[model samples]
Target: MPELLTTSGNIALTPATFQHRLLEWYDRHGRKTLPWQQDKAPYRVWVSEIMLQQTQVATVIDYYRRFMARFPDVHALAAASQDEVLHLWTGLGYYARGRNLHKAAQILVERYGGEFPVHSLEAMTALPGIGRSTAGAIIAISTGQRGVILDGNVKRVLARLHAVAGWPGKPAVERELWRLAERYTPDERLDDYSQAIMDLGATLCKRGTPSCLFCPFEDVCLAHAQGEERRFPESKPRKVLPERQTIMLLLRNEEGRLLLEQRPGAGIWGGLWCFPQFDDREALSRWIDAKAPGAILEPAWNSFAHTFSHFRLHIVPQPARCKRTGHVSEVDTLWYDSARPANIGLAAPVKQLLNASRPFAAQPSF
Candidate 1:
């Protein structure tokens, strides 16, 4: 590891020195009032960690509060149905995280008596969604144990501090950062130290326009020294996201209830409720004709796009007022009432479409 000099250019900033300075800053500015921080229970910390993965703290607060209100502990979460758990998770983009979290809770309740295996990193990582860094955070934050985390925020902070080269997604680069994370993690005050590093990165060493002057490592940060604070922790190689188009069927019943289908358990928007989709207008028309012979198909609503990490989905919401012939299966299909929405998961785009359909809800009587 390269040595970093202090502001006077006279002394080296060792690991101990680094921890001390970070903790000092944390004592003043670190986020101590986050919903999860108030109660450092392993379950709470674990949920917060999962929610915060690839999600901003500001966006997670309300979701976390609602989730905790429903499922107060691992036992409660485990006992709840997947639909109920996922219902609370709607609007939180990553559905897989929500699924794995519920599964892990079940595993913990069944195998570990609903208690976290705080002493065992292996046990913690063995859980469905708990990776190494997340496990480290849970143990350290909940128990104040010696645990090191290399979350995105920490990765950015450390990458610039030593000016680490290469995209952090690379195995080599990630391994090096993990080593640095451990080297600097203090023995005492593990909870504060963990939060401090993450806070420093989020607040000061931001992805764009970092506040270099206010940073604790302002003078010692190698990237700052080179006037290339954003250069380190190289970005992943870019790729053109493929665009896929689909027609979303917004079939409404006489009672003004919208029809929704539970998506297959493993795909885009898995395990969530979504409007029936068709490849094109012809296919949509065919399904409508076969299912509801006298259903009135309205003009297609304005097209919109919902971009995912891998692809862009162009959605054309095809609204329809239909008379049902027989009872619809309740297993995978549902009649959703907007006023009394069931606790079921809906993707962001589906929710948007539902909201958009509100103004046009009073269809002409047949």
Candidate 2:
């Protein structure tokens, strides 16, 4: 008989029954020392959880620590400028997450007095970027409340255990995941259990080449029983990401200051700073013709390519020197001294291009 099948005092291997084995395995081997788990506060959990989305744990640790040191609490985050908040989040891609976090902090301050709205999942989810799963994480992990979470890790773990077919993104799969999540959640040791399952999935039942031998449900995992662990959590339908092309103007003044613009609150790299962009060579020429009529434009070395999850951006870098100082009447634009990096948020592609071209700017072969 399987170890899991014989455990639980002869009861069937159920969610509640499964809970004991999970917690026991967790007590012996689960992750208990994450940075977020150390402080275990709602605000901290919320920030870490948001950062962990579409991001890895090793990458989030330094960012989390630096962010906490800078903001310390919701009030600090709310009081700080959006630029300040985003500046702290440089290289942590998905700028929208930083924008939403700043917006949510402001909302929390206004409504909940910056207290994180504990004990009320509804209130927390009302804030920008705080979804049901995130709110549930904050409540359960911080406040010891019984809350069910279906984050990617938990989803993968549950999906494989039950051999749940289809992509978890589907509404039907989501409903099933929620139902199973609720069933597995226990009233006692809520915080530990929540963290345990997440840890189990993250550390053992990973997306590829999972350590099934170490998993608590190894004996009863349907996917394991059938030798289809890799096939259980079916992936989403595949589609080719669209390609986007743009020309970025890398203009510098006599003082060697680079021209940067604050992008709008929507679209790619929203709420971040970047060079003025145009569709192609013609658009770039037209913009220079209109804005900096006497500017000397020259194409940089090779173009740069940046890939987002949903699209690929092919960027043509054009370096120019404006004959005279002028201002645009459209958006908030500024001249930043390239000698000294600006303490503001820069899109990854923008930063990459800027750094790559700066040393060769004066000695350009073009």
Candidate 3:
């Protein structure tokens, strides 16, 4: 394991000096042209903060612009339908953020007359998807209130600056980092300071090959001084991703409508439309034989492999043409107009498969 720098052999940081040095560095080189920095309105800040969670700033840039164009304000978000919100948030992996944003907007409209409650931390956290760090950031940036932010970028910056040991996810390390964050946050110019610190961490104090030469705190950064900046906040143990095999049945009617089912709202790819999936080939064959006895099973067109954070999905696509127009009792399915897949929430990979199969679906034979 790598070592962290110690202050007076104490191994902890001197918060006052650290804050002064970091703030000075921020004034000189921190990011200043981000979209969120242009405006400090509660809605703008809140939207950007939510979108930035577990997502890169570069990736969030265009998404933020389009999202703002659609919603414009909290009231607009609250009024939009769930489908509409999800549609705008497609390609953004975390669907829960969109749902929570919509929920919080509704709450804001109902409870606070469409205005964000900026006075208290408790009031802010009471809104959906706004945890401690998010609530703190909103209040700090929008209202100039002093608070701590502990996102991944800030965590990496602090861990390297102080050479804090142990995983940041652990409670003890998190508590120490929180204390450091609170200590460094200036009482005045709180919003600019907050954004500055985040920008510093993101731009110069990055995860890989950090540009320490341009960093404001390079002079005093313990990890940099110790020649082990990349080793701070020791990496966690890795786990093997389990693999799961499944079959996706593409059942189509004579009129070229493909069957898709809406997934239940609480699991992998929740609330998205996907083809009827089965765990085993035996079960799938039995389902097809019993449900559509006279249907013609076409050769498999393609296979899709998608990896989630926790597991890997092997989707085997089997196309079949059904003779009957009526619904099958066993399968929870519906035949959708193949051209208008946007009517439902289809996962990205499934959408790709549909698009790939468009030419085949348009032809007379499967």
Per-residue CA lDDT of candidate 3, range 57-129, in tens?
Answer: 9999998998888889989999988768877777777777887898999999999999988988899998989
lDDT ranking from best to worst? 1, 2, 3
Better of 2 and 3 by TM-score: 2
lDDT tens readout by residue for model 2, 213-264 = 8777887788887788999689988799899988888888777778889998
lDDT of 3: 0.80
Q: CA shift at 102, candidate 1, in angstroms?
A: 0.8
Where in model 2 is the C-alpha error above 4 Å?
A: 1-11, 327-331, 360-366
Which candidate, 1 or 3, has the higher lDDT? 1
TM-score quality measure for candidate 2:
0.93
Question: Candidates' TM-scores?
Answer: 0.94, 0.93, 0.88
Error of 3 at 324 (Å): 4.1
